[model samples]
Target: MRAPCERSERHRSVARRRWISRASWACLMAACLGGAAPPFVSSVSFAQQPGARQAPPPAVVVEKIEVQQVSNPAQFTGRVEAIEAVDIRARVTGFLHSVDFKDGQAVKAGDTLFEIEPDQLNALVASARAQVARADATRISAERSLARNRDLLARRTVSQATVDEVQAAFDVASADVQVAQAALDTAELNLSYAHITAPISGSIGRATFTTGNLVGPDSGSLARIVSLDTVRVAFAVTEGLLVTIRQQQASGGGLDPNTLKLSLRLANGTDYGTPGRIEFIENEIDPQTGTVAARAVFPNPRHILLPGQFVTLYVQEKDAPSLPVVPQTAVLQDREGRFVYLLGKDNIVSQQRIHTGARVGNGWAVTKGLDGGEQVVVEGIQRLAQGMTVQPSQGQPVGGGT
Candidate 1:
């Protein structure tokens, strides 16, 4: 044998040459057809290949612009007020013998609220009656003397001067009797004032003066009474809103105080089930707040509404015109103003600039840049690009409950 090792080496050399020739042939064939693809093909090129799977368009939730005839209510922080409020005060100077009503009690007109010590008043009345009796006796004696003097003068037993003097005495006694009667009347009237009574029908506040406390007319206020059957709320509105109201009223539009729908939301975020009507609007705008004051009246049968309670007041114009509304989620903001992504035909998304106004429920009242029946993208607006293709689905109703 020539050598086993030499024979094995020759076979390896033959295989390497055969493999090189085959690689060159393949490269030449790829160059003749087109440029050779890289060893690692990019995803972009793979997608461009015929029969390759295509990625679906981005999905978005869209809603049709609703032309709602609902009122675009404006809300403001309001303070509750009593339709009629009164400060209770003592009318007579006296020591309080008893407080008839408890704190925060409901009282009616003519209800006795407090009792004053009446011993001194009773003594004054007795003294006045005694004075009246003494004056009456003096008048009777003077009248008898005047009559006797007149008869004597007629019978020539008395002079005209003596009769005239007796007449003057009778006149003085009569005047004294009248003055005493007036004093007695005054005493009785004061006695009535000792029993303090409520002047209105409403809920009463806590008494400032308890029993044994001296109270008088000069004492500021003993307690307060607020009407519970009906209450009022006062709030401020911007000058622009006030002007619009005035214009509507002047033109006899439907925005008059009588036509407004007033509603209240308590501090605890509960609605005051009963509706209210506008009571009055202030005469002028406040210079400091740049707003005008307005008031509304609501029925408070349960006495839930109280004076000075902070609450939210919503005012809406009845029968307001229809407006295009978009869900709050669909709106986006930039330096120019507010805007929303609108879905046009061919499933294309377009950036639509809009002017927004007051909030209507869970959406914004579209003041401009949109009409009814336009499709607006609510969800998936974050990643959406202008003119991008998207797959749309019906969106959930705005303001709907879960």
Candidate 2:
């Protein structure tokens, strides 16, 4: 009874409506089972559930602060100096004949360092000897004359005035002989100067004058010698620090120069294995720099330290008092001040402000705001909040057991 074209159109519309209904049912089932609520159900479900709590404070490594005896060393820039340094120079004018020692060689006292031409000096010595011989002959003749005159005067053969004149001539001859002897001694001394010798035992620098060069007393220096067995390190400290040291000494908290320990760090950041002692302190403080100069002596048996080398001098007071110290990593700074997270009785982290002093090895010396026997958070400090509860575990204190 219906037309065939109209029936075909109705069948296609019914099939499309059924397919859409099945797709909507599958989506709803996937959302509910996968724990993903549909947009319309999300707000309703959240309202029905209880409120969520914050995550537990992160687990942190904590350690109890302990007091220990530590030397709070102070570091200052310094320079190495030789115990004895000398500039080798020629004492006479002559042509340089030879250099006895090689450049940068170790030398002992009385070692020949240079040789100057001695031909002229030898001629002078011969001339002086001839003069001495002439003066000696004159003295002999004058003495004989005086003796004969004295005998004649006793025998009444000569007058008193003639004997007196002969005695005066003998005295003049004797004086001439003495003067010639002195001249000969001076010539010999000049000859000795031609062969220059080392004045002290030390390492020698390069020679400034070579063979064939005219060397003289006015020549600045032929070479340099520096004693390296023991070296001195000179450094300057602030006046304020000096005052504090004196005050500590008065209170028995500081050490004397003999008892203090010193160490050096080379420019390349390597430690000098040998230890040194503070041997000298300047008598007056430098007014312009507001500093006091101090010096320490170190034994350099192998000649490891060289003069004029820059280094760092570390001064440590022996027998220093014990103080509360914490790992440097535990300390933190902010707008307020430097502080550390302390774990109290209930495992609550509290930010405790601290006044820090010099570094004691890898730890910080606490000057104030902290007593011994308090847990300090070292690992989880970054995540910590004031008054936050945390689970703390014991860990080794920093600086390897300190």
Candidate 3:
């Protein structure tokens, strides 16, 4: 029952609102799609920029490889030994009268060390001398009697038997004289033994027997003396090392064990001022140890090296011929082996495997795998990779340079 014109106007208004809502939805979808599409496109463009133009490689410090003479030293641990060690002992039976030297005093050869009771020995010597005189007088008297008997026999004043008897008596007296002379010499020798003297010139240890103490051949060492002006160092070298040394000598490498120079480091970690030379090598290898015994002589003018002290011995070899060398910092080890980074043309880093020898100063002696005149990376190695570009700068030369 409503008006027809009002109903028609309401329907038209509903259609217009629906059309505006559809149009607004389409515009919102288009805006969201446009914003999302730009970021995807921009990401692709940004990645492509790096591909077109690469960044410069990381910077590193490098040194040119050079060959130089290097020294190889073999080291060993050894013990210091005295050139001469003597023990003082009494050679005869006597009561020690006095000690002539202080404890631990240095003494020269023939220095009096102790004096035993000489009273009894002196009396024996005197008694032997008196007996010798008595024997001589008796022999003279017997000889005179024999001569008188012989003259009497020629003149027929005495019987031939009496002459024979006198001659026999003279012979007996001569034999007695010889016995007395032997006894005197024995007594004199015994007296000499009563005074103990140092047999060598060296520092002596404490005396085991004091004044008034009984010391004789039965007693042990009275004291000990060790010569320190020249000392010896003894060390054992393995059979393998001994073989190597022999091989070097046979090859005419100019390594003579007798003339090899040596140096020592004391237990206190100080270098001995004087150098030494190899003196003796045992003729036979020790069966128990399978090593050869070697000794070196060192002049210990100041007596700094004492017996039983431990020290380190260094044997320097002749300078090896010049060889390729590189900074130790440039040497790297991995599962493969020892390798170093070499900067080649186009500033590209490549791994170079190397055979390293003895350390020469702060660098390594490269025996193989690297020729001379190659640039080796010394710094910033951790940032390096195979075939990676690098910015190399000149650094200190390795192995003292060319």
lDDT of 1 by residue, 240-326 (tens): 987886787788873556666778889888888998987777898899989999888889898898888999988777667777888
TM-score of each: 0.72, 0.75, 0.77
Best by TM-score: 3
**Whole-model lDDT values for every prediction:** 0.87, 0.89, 0.89
Instruction: Sum up the clashes in candidate 1.
Output: 0
Lowest summed lDDT window (length 10), candidate 3: 253-262
Clashing pairs for predicted structure model 3, backbone only: none
Q: For candidate 3, write residues 190-275 as lDDT tens digits.
A: 99999889999999999888888888887999999999999999999889988987888788874766545588998888999999
lDDT for each residue of candidate 2 in 292-346, tens digit (9 for 90 to 100): 8988899999998999999998887666767788888899999989999999878
lDDT (0-100) at residue 60 of candidate 3? 98
Pairs that clash in candidate 2: none
**lDDT over C-alpha atoms for residue 32 of model 2:** 75
Q: Could you tell me the lDDT of residue 216 within candidate 1?
A: 94
